[model samples]
Target: MSERGGPPQQPIIVRRVHRRGHGHHGGAWKVAYADFVTAMMAFFLVMWLIGVGTREQRAAISEYFRNPSLVPGNATLAPPGRMGPGGASDSAIKLGGAMDLPHGPGKDTRGAAAASVDGRTVEKEARRQEQARLQELMQQLRAAIQNSQALAPFKDQLLLDITPEGLRIQIVDKLNRPMFDLGSAQLKPYTADILRELAGFINRVPNRISISGHTDDAPYSSGNRYGNWELSADRANAARRALLDGGLQDAKIARVVGLAASVPFDKAHPGDPINRRISIIVMTRQAEAAALSQELADEDAAPPAATAGPAAASPAALPAASAAAAAAAPGVLVH
Candidate 1:
């Protein structure tokens, strides 16, 4: 037969047969897979517990894992009436059999409570003594202001009051006599003299000092970059610098705040010259403790999470606006 005329060539046929597993390779791999899955589940559960549990709860869980016998009877796994090892009652289970006595947890808790009470009492007594000392110091400061030749001229501008925080002294502006130059944060010669005298008396007290700057309701203009808040803060910082220059210790000033017009000396007259002033407060021990606690709390807080957009930016971080509107905002200047 001719090759071309040969019957249609048959298509090539290929067969592939996959082999099955050998009989000897039994279910060993299945067992291993099961074990791996169980281990993973247990790991995930432990991670979840650690992530969600509080400090005390985590400590308790860790103790239980270290020594299962240490788990209290109140736990779901343990019976209520059962006693722990080493003859400890169910009410008290000392870990690792450390305590041989049968005393309950209540005894230790009571002792701790008593100690706390005693500590509070001692703190109270110490605070009372400090208040008395600060009171005496306030009187001395008033007397010194009245008697001192340099401070006498400014006495009319200075007002003294005893507040809950401690002694509060306010220095206010007069119609013709301002503490600072117009539209500047520079301390005048007389203002410096008054602050210098104040620093000398303030040094005699152990309490910390707090300085604040205030302004009238009249608007201020400092380009768009500066506003009332910035101006007030600058004046306060300027006052702080003057106090430090006048023999006051750097550590003595606890806070320098700028209230702007929030706290007006003359409440009925927001635009009054007296509303533009500087305040110095000698903080009481209790107030100081509270302030320190708040500071620590603020410091220990976590940073805010970042977000996309200008909305995430803080007001303090945002770019300044036009000064046209800021001209109406209250501000401070130290001359």
Candidate 2:
């Protein structure tokens, strides 16, 4: 029972409907997931940096991002809290890690680095202060010498220099104004006065002192039969006594050496007027004493070969005599 058109008739409808992705909601979600992953990776990198970087390095980095000009060199940068030209974020500055801060007593790396810097600064300051004090002391000594009327005559004969050993004052002898009378160990009145003034300065400083006596190469004709070595020693001892009498503490004087003609001022010209002088050396550091001691030990430990020439000759002569006896005895043995 099929009617002409009704038997096979189908309904027809026209409409448009948008369907979601079968596998995914939308590509927008994919973009969000990618952003999230990138943020997590950046966070992990920041954590790693924070863990390994020193306090100073971290602060430098933070300060660099905050104000690139503040870095050692004037490097250009983008604004703070923003990505740089290469898409590098300045988020490290905002993180405020342990190294980002200025180190206090026990804050972070900042503290430790600051402590080291401060310690170095203090040491430098101490050295500068010490140098200034030494310069001031030298100036005072110069002024004292200049002001002393007694030292006026010896001013031209005096030579002063600053060495690693300390202050060295040399008193050269003048032909007419000798520091002492001929063949006498006593200091002249004027020389004594000069020493007194020098002694005052020496007593103020906390350094060891040495007084050395030198003599001209001229042979002793004083009729006392004393040579330059004895004369030089007497003179050194006399000077040491004068210094002690003039307010220098006995303990402060480290040594008194009579160099005689051994250490001349002018080796090429032994008769040079400057060769006959006394030297007062002040020791600034203990190393100077140690060096001097080593030098003395080396001198005392001279090789035996250098000193054995006479002894060796004597033994050689004995050997020759023994050979002559042996040759003379050969004929006697036959008899």
Candidate 3:
């Protein structure tokens, strides 16, 4: 095609496709920028975690991301002799932590552990609140003992403390002022008055009470059928009656027991007059439930059979370790 009359001189024309901006304002650049920001954020998050977390946490995190794989909780690309397609191993073949996430026996173990931890936390909080309430009750009783003119006279005998079971109020015997008549379960007039006074204060709480009577090492001469055990039991029952007469609810009495001389208040001096005492424990709800359970079991026509030999006999009959453990642990908690 000759345009200029000579051999083929083409017309010169320039066609320019103008770009608004040099790809800087395009969506692709925005996407790249977003990726950059995400990378920076992830980097900073990793750094923050490194600063805050423990060594174990860091190791676990590192292990979690060590090999980026499709399967979670499994890291192996291909286990030896168990290789699958694409020269890799399946989730079942991977040998690592979090056993069988997609499917297996221990898949729910972590969930169970988390649930257990939560349960423990809740239990701890409840226990703390209960302890605070019991402490407040103790303070109230102490203040009463301090302010009341009638109770101040026998303040030396009134011993109050907190046990895991509940708040224990022990009325000990002084050398000059014995709580009961000589060699008898009969309470003195003053002792009865004291118990009567305590009844109203204790009735303020809804908690049930456990009454336990203790004796000194002195042997009571009442024959084999009735000795210190019977005397202590009678004394505890007497105290219970006094409390009841003083306006305590009949249902408030959970248990009444006499320990004889088995658990002396003054272990250093077992024969001390203070060893002969009465312990009134205001039991917690949990403890009350346990007590009820035990009582129900005992009352059942066919109780669960314990080993015939050891638990039946005295702690003295057991091995040294067993005896020590028995002494340390709260057996039946209260009477």
Candidate 4:
């Protein structure tokens, strides 16, 4: 109510109140935050510079940090004498923009190149050793043919080849003269003789033997259960038996498989008689070692057999089998 109702008194104003503390005391925290940001930026800048330096430059920088007072390259006087290490700038340090990363263990370029060279050298040496071994084996076979007269009668039928597996001795079939019966695994008399003859000579070497039987693409005539695959396997086994009869050690046999028309001798003529044949592979030491990796651990590879006599081999490699094979399979039978 206005005094004595003269006028409507205005409501007493109470809109203002005092604040407790003036705004944020001063900006001390801002100065501290600015300093922290600046320090971080400087740190990252130094890291970037170090990251972009060359190997030698980085080394020099690291050395400088280790001993900042020491100067390089006889840089004794810089300002007073006006002398420097062959440059207008008194600094001996080279700040070339070499962005080479620091090398750690196993990261050296020279070491890697040397390792590659060593690998190539090893491969070449292995190749040379394999060739020497094959040549020695060939010489042994030639001497056997000349001296023993075992293969003289059927020399024309023999075919020799060098394959990645090793030396392959292919005994192919002729038109009228077949190694096995027309459609059976039964060996002809001549076939058995040839296998036996080959066995005796092959036995002299320390190498193991592999026999594979192949057949023509023609299907078998009879037997619902038996087929060409079975026949081929049986034929290979039969050959193995003949080899055993010819005094080849039982342990000399490595593998016997049947490949019925899979790897045909005459690809153009799948049904050719020559396709029906037996292959005797004298597996190289490398191949033999690879086989051992799948089956069992083998002995360390011996150096190639000594090149002494045509039929040179360890007398200890006699065909007693049980003990002799164990002794001979590891080392080359050097006479």
Candidate 5:
């Protein structure tokens, strides 16, 4: 319909609408982030605790976490599925069993224990026992020698010692009773008695013996062709024979060596009275003549070419030299 001189006007309608500025602050994301951080921290703490704790400590920890109420003060709860602090499950405490404790210091609760001994220790103990026995025997021998009127005079000249080789008894020559006559290798009467008593003592021992003769650095007379070397050897052999006759077994005599004046007893005083002596050595199991002979034979049987190379060349060239040079070389022969 038309009104107030206007072309066909429609009816007007009014309505009010309010626009909200922004939604209320949503804290759900913040809560989720805080929960994630707390979970990560708890996981790391558990890992650290596990790494440092022993088996027993770990079992105790599992019990504590599963059921705080299962602790000593709070034992009224049920065995399993009981509430812990903050209402968590108590299943871990009921399921946990006793754990093995760690070993303390000095406790060897492992496998079968060892014997705590070896070959070297046994050998050392045996050697110690042998040495003690030998020392006791030496004391007895010394007492016997001191009590004998015939051996008392020779006590000062005798030396008894325990060496690496074994027991060594040396009889040194003095001015009053020389072990042998001036130039001859004959033993005196009293010397023979003393040797007989020594032989009696040696017969009791089950070890091998070595008789060695040494001389002072005194040159022989020109008229006498024989030198100290031959005299020493003869004297040593004579002593061996006398010992055998005096009840010492021949099988126990290992070797008879004559060093002449090469190995002096007192090096500072080469011609000392002690240098002229007869040394009776009891050989140890290791230093026996048999072992030395075996070692020597092995050395000798090694390739002759390896041992003879340099020594053979000089002998081969000596055949072309003068006869006088060859003769002067002792064992050399000239063509």
Candidate 6:
């Protein structure tokens, strides 16, 4: 203090108080918070979609999430330049076609088209061969029925026709000569002989068979449980047994059902004896696949508790869900 002439008697100390700006809650924290909110919103949106979607739709969505890069129509993330053979960017070669670029995106359009055409052609050929084989089978069945002494008398009751489903052979009930006892599932000796004769030819073919029973629309109320449904199903099962007795393998029976007057042969007269009949359909490959898919869908829709006992032992019953999925593919019957 004495060394300086201006400040003489006392030394003055200047103290500065530096105050920090309000608690530095930086923009980074805000950014993190915003990101969290956005992620939560997306999560909620995905949950809503899953809740409303069907099984197939849900599977598709799951697949998309698993690999978003593989989704169609997604823009390819690439630099605008030629990539060297080793995958390095080569700036020297500019991207140009004949007019403006050398080539389009790296896609094999010709190969894809060729593959699609080949697939369609193969399917067409398969269908044609299947049709021819089924036609030959139909002719053989007609000849066999006409030649058989056991089935010759009952020829008027048998109806054979080729349908999109394949060869359909229906044995209609006559007013005078019913196939079964009056209102019973028991088959007459003549009906059994006819079914057995058909089975001999049916077993020779690789195609699977679908058996169904139909009934007239008469009012039936025997007790509380027994009805036309049970009767019809029993009759179909009886026919299935007869076919097995005549050499048809159990695995060859693709479907056995009871229509119970729903699909009538004589629609004009629902109560006609002709409507009360048994139908055997040799399923085409396409028809069999479609029918199996439908059955699987129905089974998946049913509850687990309904898959047991005689009430559930109908032909409409499911095998295993895994079995259904494993069998689901476009082709002839695997067995």
| TM-score between candidate 5 and the true structure | 0.53
The 10 consecutive residues of candidate 4 with the worst lDDT sum are 315-324
Off by over 4 Å in 6: 1-107, 304-335
Span of ten consecutive residues with least summed lDDT in model 6: 68-77
lDDT comparison, 3 vs 4, better candidate: 3
C-alpha lDDT of residue 119 in model 1: 69
Per-residue lDDT of candidate 1, residues 197-258 (tens digit):
88988888889888878778788776676766566667888999889889999999988776
Error of 2 at 143 (Å): 1.3
Residues 160-214 of candidate 2 have per-residue lDDT tens digits of: 8765556778888887888888767888887778777788888877777777788
Candidate 1 RMSD to the correct structure: 23.6
Query: What residue pairs clash in candidate 2, if any at all?
Result: 103-110, 103-111
Best by lDDT: 3
Residue-level lDDT of model 5, residues 175-220, one tens digit each, is 6679888867788877777888888888776778888777888886
Best by TM-score: 6
- Comparing 2 and 4 on lDDT, the stronger one: 4
Pull out the clashing pairs in model 5. Answer: none
Q: Which ten residues in a row have the lowest lDDT in candidate 3?
A: 314-323
**lDDT measured at residue 45 in model 1 versus the true structure, 0 to 100:** 96
Q: What lDDT score is found at residue 294 in candidate 3? A: 64
Which regions of candidate 4 are displaced past 4 Å? 1-120, 146-148, 289-335
Which stretches of candidate 3 lie above 4 Å from their native place?
A: 1-111, 289-335
Error of 3 at 158 (Å): 0.0
Q: TM-scores for all candidates?
A: 0.60, 0.51, 0.60, 0.51, 0.53, 0.62
TM-score of 3: 0.60
Error of 6 at 19 (Å): 99
lDDT of 6 by residue, 215-243 (tens): 89886687756667677778999999999
